[model samples]
Target chain A: MTSFVGPELTNPRAERVKAVRALSGRSMRQRTGRYLVEGPQAVREVVRFASVHELYVTAAAADRYSDVISDAHERGLPVHLASDEVVAAMSPDAQGLVAVANVSSATLDDVLASRPTLVAILASVRDPGNAGAVIRAADAAGADAVVLTLESVDVHNPKTIRATAGSLFHLPVVTGIALDTVTDALRAAGLAVLAADGSGAHDLDDLLDVAGPAGAGDRSAAPDLAAPTAWVFGNEAWGLPAHELELADAVVRVPIRGQAESLNLATAAAVCLYASARAQR
Target chain B: MTSFVGPELTNPRAERVKAVRALSGRSMRQRTGRYLVEGPQAVREVVRFASVHELYVTAAAADRYSDVISDAHERGLPVHLASDEVVAAMSPDAQGLVAVANVSSATLDDVLASRPTLVAILASVRDPGNAGAVIRAADAAGADAVVLTLESVDVHNPKTIRATAGSLFHLPVVTGIALDTVTDALRAAGLAVLAADGSGAHDLDDLLDVAGPAGAGDRSAAPDLAAPTAWVFGNEAWGLPAHELELADAVVRVPIRGQAESLNLATAAAVCLYASARAQR
Candidate 1:
């Protein structure tokens, strides 16, 4: 394990304050190659999921979450004590824990290699919560990985991380991949690409039938849980864009029999992912 | 159309600085009997789902969202235009729309009378997102209403409302009912008490079999979406407590075959509710 310590600052209105605030802005977060995560739960997930470059905690929270600090320290992460004001200056809802980690964005190529793929690609999921919830669901469904488009919310955003429920650390999450490229890569890998659309040509279960074990019938006696498959979820507001719809091998719906409009992005993704897992198994 | 004219404040800090900051404190939210909502989408949802007692929009936002204001007015809701600072004061993330609605916490008795006769009870869900998602799922699944234990997150919490995706307005949500009373009430209605648990004795499909339009083989063929039934979801963190589990006539699991620990609370609820709707339809 390796550790690197940065210089400490006493000023509440120091140069780093601007940088910290920059994290809230999309451009700044991307340019700086860092995204801020707040609260104990999020901080813990970051530590468990990604390698941390810096750790900050208020004296009180540091005392309260000693185990977390020690875990980070054990991983040789630099641990620092920031005055409560300092932490507050960095984030309005810091929850007394902050960490700076290297942002590792995934690509279409990376997702292709993962086995038993339970992938969720947000074509244009705008809401941070929806994007976050889908990512969380992808992680929960034990998908091989998750991928988000350029139009999707940043996976490192605090809200998205919180929605992931620490599953962010459990799997590889790729972002900024063009839908066409992902479609091609998935096809090349022999993985079926299933898109979730409210008015698709086929029901979701049909696609599950093609990709799942039992549905495959006599071709294979036992359902294979590790079958290569990817499930795509559309935008939180508009759902999958038309151009991206063409990218999917199949477009399946969750089958909303009632008058209700649609399931939330995360909920939809969960049903799709779980359905695939059930089919393959 | 009836329009509401209310207090006007110009100072951004004057309105949100206290409420936004105060919202972080559970005690303050409890004391005020009001919670904050941000952004146009959520504000729109509030007007549609929950009673919008007071709506505050910036002059620019009011001009931009005049139709929304008119819509709210048509519903007899009061919409107020304030300085950006005033809106900002109440919600740091005001994003052009913000509101403080009178919190209405319903009891199980109020929600039980709906025509659909299908209801959901959350035993001990803690995450506001999970709680809200379930409410939204219940709305989508055509469940007449939703009831939760006191231990669940406050439905009025902004996070919960946002999770509901505006379904909160159309659905009757009751909270703080005891587990025993809830089970007893549902049983009295002749509704089967199906509890969703990881170790559920019966599979979800089994229940769907019994409720199906094609018939579960035991009954005459007749699909009834309006059947009297109650679907229960347990705590996100620790699932249903043992005592509450005892109240269920049948405990059913969603059947997760993946390596993922468990489906998220709201996702699990959606699966169960949708399955029920599938059977009835």
Candidate 2:
């Protein structure tokens, strides 16, 4: 049976605790090569999937999420039992459990080598929640991978991780690549790169209707949904700039039947991804 | 041309400013029957689509958003030009523009009387952002209206208003209705009620496959997406309760082809609503 290791970390102001908490900042995360995964759900996922270094939890939290502790111990990861005050000092949003994990990611070239059929690329999407939501949606839609441009929010940011709801560990997310580079590489790998924007020439529904063998006549106007495809979603505020829009093979708009100006970044991404997944199936 | 109505408001600590700031509180809003709409986008919408009580903007913001002010004036609205500090004090996130508008909504009966073809119901969804995002998606899907159960977050919450991104004024949102009443009423109005859950017996994509007249076999088990329909989305954390699920004619699950446990509330709602919207079209 796995048990708590080491003496109880009782000091809230300890240097180790401070270092762990400091991972919340980008500089600290970069210098230490580690990031914080807060809350039971995320901590469990990190322990199960990522290369986790350590874990800290209060006595009650250990009791509540016994399986998490058991799993961590099974992985030979150090599990520290800390005082409630110490855990509180670690993170207010952690719900009494947190972990220090290495900042890990898959490279674009590596992911492209696998010849992924469905991919989602986020361009300059800085909002952590929006970025994380899109990642989760992409995963749910059966996308092979998600690529975030260099300007996008950090996937390891606590808010982004939390928004992902453990889905961060479910899929391969490629980060630190430029948008143009990503489009070029994916296109070379035999995938149609489509951009989602309000000003798109084709409506998403019309494309869905003409999808698969059901579509007849001149199909040159629209990209095939059954083929390998990648969707590029712009920032939450200003949509894809004209130069970026031109990078895609074709631009498709989610049909707006009501008076809404547009759907939020995450929702629109989900719609487009699901539509493609449906057609491919 | 309509210009600033009177002397500029110069005092950030003035009673009027504090009164406006206090509108952010639920008690204050309930007492005054008004809610705060922050940012130029929302303020412009409130001025155009709702009964606005007051407009507060700095001279710079007024000049930049001259159309919002011009439209407000055209509607016989009293516009107040305030100092930067004064406007900031009124609401920090307003971006130099804010409005006070009456808290308005439609009754369930009234919405049903219009013979709506599509509707979205949020059941016990306490997250304001989730509630607002669903409303925006519903509007985008061309749903006739949105209904929030009594236990749902107040639609007038500033965070909710911000999440809607000005779509709050585009469609009628009915609040304070119970889930049972919403389901019963919508079903009676000739709309099939569907509850979205992870453990649903019917897969959403399969239903879409067999939707409309294209199916050769008996379609009695599945709810037709092309028919008038209402979708009930559960809370973000805990999905619909057993009693709530029992109210729907059919329970549908969004297919999860990846390791992602589930899609977030808003994205799932958007996918389902868009599916229905496409089928209906």
Candidate 3:
């Protein structure tokens, strides 16, 4: 690995620093075809999974995370040593490490081309934090991909990326597609699209019952969770509208055993995704 | 009902306003023995389940949420009209409604005295948001109570209260108890304490399989979720210590089917609580 012995970039208003700071905004990210990944966990994942256009690290952070710097340089990616002020200027939440990476141009068609067995479709999910948490849950559930419809929060939002906790780099996440398009594509792929909502006719427990136990023999008698499936989560406040629910094969509700009116989007997504993961595994 | 034609308080520095604002801080909350509940949902819940010391609403809010005002008056609670500035000073997220309510003095002994069938114990959870989400999940799962160790986040933190999404009033949440005391008391009460951690001897799926379906006959043949049980969730970042995990009867792991390193504390708690809910119901 080539040693990155370059002088540390201390000027916060440097031309390169301004460009990196601009990546924090949506229009700039879209225009430049790049996004910022902050913190070591996110930076590490981005470097490993996506093409890192450039890596920035404070001198102290560089020493603390030499492996990351070496790995980036070994990948033929430039590693810049930035001062603490420069790092802070890019993103306050960045723990002395940040990276500018090219945003993936993967489309829904590209993701579906792999015939994903399990997918998460977010329809009109507005909160960046919730969207990212759902993506993390989907990644933990081993879902093949995550689809954010046109109205969903931007996947490149910094808060969303932070909430993903590095899972954003672990799986394919397609964004900006229409909800109808996603449902049709997943259905055509032979995956059952289940809408998660409180007013659903079916209970999650009943669905799991029909799916049988994980790794059980005579699985053919069960609902076949091993079969391709997609879970469509709705907006946080209003949840899935009637038309949206109608698009799915069935609407499933996580049974509220207590007085809680409903689960939040991310928690609901976690329970639903984990249920599918348990059944499929 | 008595008519509330009281003069509207417009000053942000009003004594009542300062008192409500002081509830936002922990020391003030402890000194005054009261806390602030913001938003219509939280304020409504406080009026219904807890004793409201005072209810403050802006003119527009009073018009929008006349039901809440009427309910508070019906409950013999004082209702005061405040300027938007005063309400904003108390809490920017109050949505024109805020309430000062006496803090619940419920103890671990009081909670266990009811012979809780299912409970959630939080050990050293630091994040207010995570703590609130766990409480919400526990409420959704029909947990009888929630226990937070001394090391855990303050249950009355405004952010934590908001995170609970009004579920904070749905159940009894006992805080500031020692972890050892909680586990010991739970065990003495004949409740099996299950520590939820990534590293565990038993898989959640296997445990669920043993629990069988909800409302199934011959629950004695399987692990009966209807039986008294307590699930202990750890901190957000480092999770439970080895000593803490060993205190429980068994350590259970939520199987990670995907490439994700692990689930967030709140999501994991949701899955664990729901599993118990499904088996119990």
Which candidate ranks first by lDDT, i.e. highest? Answer: 2
Q: Which regions in candidate 3 have their CA more than 4 angstroms from the true location?
A: A212-226, B212-226
What is candidate 3's CAPRI-style docking category based on DockQ? medium
Can you write out model 2's per-residue Cα lDDT over A123-214, one digit (the tens) per residue? 99999999999999998999999999999998888999999988888888999899999999999998989999999998988888778765
Model 2 steric clash pairs: none
Across B64-141, the per-residue lDDT of candidate 1 in tens digits comes to 777778778778766776777666667667776887776676666665554446788988788887888888788877
What tens-digit string does per-residue lDDT give for candidate 3 at A213-244? 45234423334455578999999989999999
Query: RMSD of each candidate?
Result: 7.1, 1.8, 3.4
User: Of all true interface contacts, what fraction is found in model 3?
Assistant: 0.76
Docking class for model 2 is high
Q: Pick the candidate with the highest TM-score.
A: 2
Report the number of the highest-DockQ candidate.
2
What DockQ do the predictions score, one after another? Answer: 0.31, 0.89, 0.78
Candidate 1 has which clashing residue pairs, if any?
B11-B85, B12-B85, B12-B86, B15-B89, B15-B90, B16-B89, B16-B90, B17-B89, B49-B169
Comparing 2 and 3 on DockQ, the stronger one: 2
lDDT of each: 0.72, 0.91, 0.87
**Selected candidate, larger TM-score, 1 vs 2:** 2
Query: Model 1 residue B105 lDDT?
Result: 68
Q: In what order do the candidates fall by lDDT, top score first?
A: 2, 3, 1
TM-score of each: 0.70, 0.97, 0.94
lDDT of 2 by residue, B1-281 (tens): 64887999999999999999999999999999999999998998888888898899998999899999999989988899999999999898989999989887888878988999999999999998998899999989999999999999999999999999888888889999888988988888888899999989989998888778654233376788888889999999999999999999889999999888999999999999998988887
Error of 3 at B61 (Å): 2.2
DockQ of 2: 0.89
